[model samples]
Target: MGLLDSWTAGSHTADGLTYPTYRKGSGPGVIVIHEIPGITPGVIGFAEQVVARGFTVVLPSLFGRPEGPASAGEALRSIARICVSQEFSLFALGRTTGCAPWLRSLARRLHDELGGPGVGALGMCFTGGFALAMLADAPIAAPVLAQPASPAPLGRARAADLGLGPADLASVKAKVAAGCQVLGLRYDRDPAVGTRFDTLRRELGDGFVAVEFPGRKHSTLTEHPQPEGVERVLAFLEEKLTTKPET
Candidate 1:
């Protein structure tokens, strides 16, 4: 059977952009934005964990072939496609990815469909910072960034960049100040993550919950599969989406 054979397939469109989505489970919503090379087995496995936890999960196939292998060639191809696509902001400093609006729309739709505290959004690898960006405008109570690598992290400026524009950053700060918290996981030596964790700490203050592991590997919640990191993520989602917030 295919890796995603059990998931319900659908499509979501916003601002003239459309992408295929796979969904499963039922309860509070969690949008799992796949990393580079598309929805591979690892990504699917992580999504299944979320589904098994009694939360609805949506996996968006941004680029690359679904159920495709995460081989070097496939990664290169996906990188090339994203580098040229107008939907991504790979090299720009302090700019939110062009796909944020569509993702935010999806989050809004999910939250509306299943009313509650709010939905959780997790982004991995190249799309990791997307959850933070979506929190600025969407009903994303729980935002998780798993090894966010963006703007190529080529220079010092790009390295510290949070992959968010000025206005969105301000909005996120406000939300965090009010009560929202962002969860970030990354390897301490992962060069692709750059200095954004520092930036998040500086910007979000006590609101950014950072879980760092050792070594230089990336893809904390998937490729590397850090057990502690996975447990922390699941806990964070439950706290923010399932439990009622104190007023």
Candidate 2:
């Protein structure tokens, strides 16, 4: 808590893409994945909140960040900029070349530098499935996947850009069979990820901890103040990351 109050930000690149990062606290590491827009102050605030709970926080701008600090208006403007940009690089920011290895390298550095067994990962909205995809690498011990967007059309049939393929899904199944638990948070509504994710829930079964917040929509879990879900998620992280080894 004391360390995070005076926290500072940093910049780095992962998977051959440049990204702005934030660091704080002084214990085991946790990677805080940003929402669709980027690593806004609200997301950083969330990182700080997690740091206050006594874990070191690492935030990579999956999408590029602003030249200045990001307020809501700034973040909204950034979204517009990306939407209007010719290339829309924000969507490709952290995903350059080989993303899985990039995340694994970052985790390795955090574990070796921070002196922890491994790192926890939390992804939101568009990037939610990433935490699960990352589980293929094994360094992602505790994964919190929130409101994942579609990887491929969904609904009565297929879904676009749902973010996982057969191999990735198979690896996840293997991890679950090995007793690894994954936590997922979502609101009852949000068609973009609604029923498709529910199917995944059934697919994963007991290996997945599904925490659905009634009446809330996508991304409220990461943003907090919803009168439900966020605090419960914090508790869930505590349960997984802070679990005692029973010998």
TM for candidate 1 is 0.98
Residue 123 Cα positional deviation in candidate 2, in Å, after optimal superposition: 0.6
For the record, the alpha-carbon RMSD of candidate 2 to the native fold, in angstroms, is 4.6
RMSD of each: 1.5, 4.6
Instruction: Flag regions of model 1 displaced more than 4 Å.
Output: 244-247
- The residue-by-residue lDDT of candidate 2 on 1-247, one tens digit each, is 4323365667665556555666777667888887756765557667777788878888875565533344566557666755664422323321311355666677777877766446788888666767876777657677887877634234344332335556777887788888778887777676656455656666687888877767645676545435356676677667666647679
Model 1 agreement with the true structure over 64-175: per-residue lDDT tens digits:
9999988899999998999899999688988898999999999999999998899999998889999988999999999999999987899999998989999999999999
**TM-score against truth, every candidate:** 0.98, 0.78
| Predicted structure with the largest lDDT when compared to the true one | 1
Q: Record all residue pairs in model 1 with backbone atoms less than 3 Å apart, i.e. clashing.
A: none
- What TM-score would candidate 2 get against the native? 0.78
lDDT for predicted candidate 1 compared with the true structure: 0.93
Could you tell me how far off, in angstroms, the CA of residue 54 lies in candidate 2 after the best superposition? Answer: 1.1
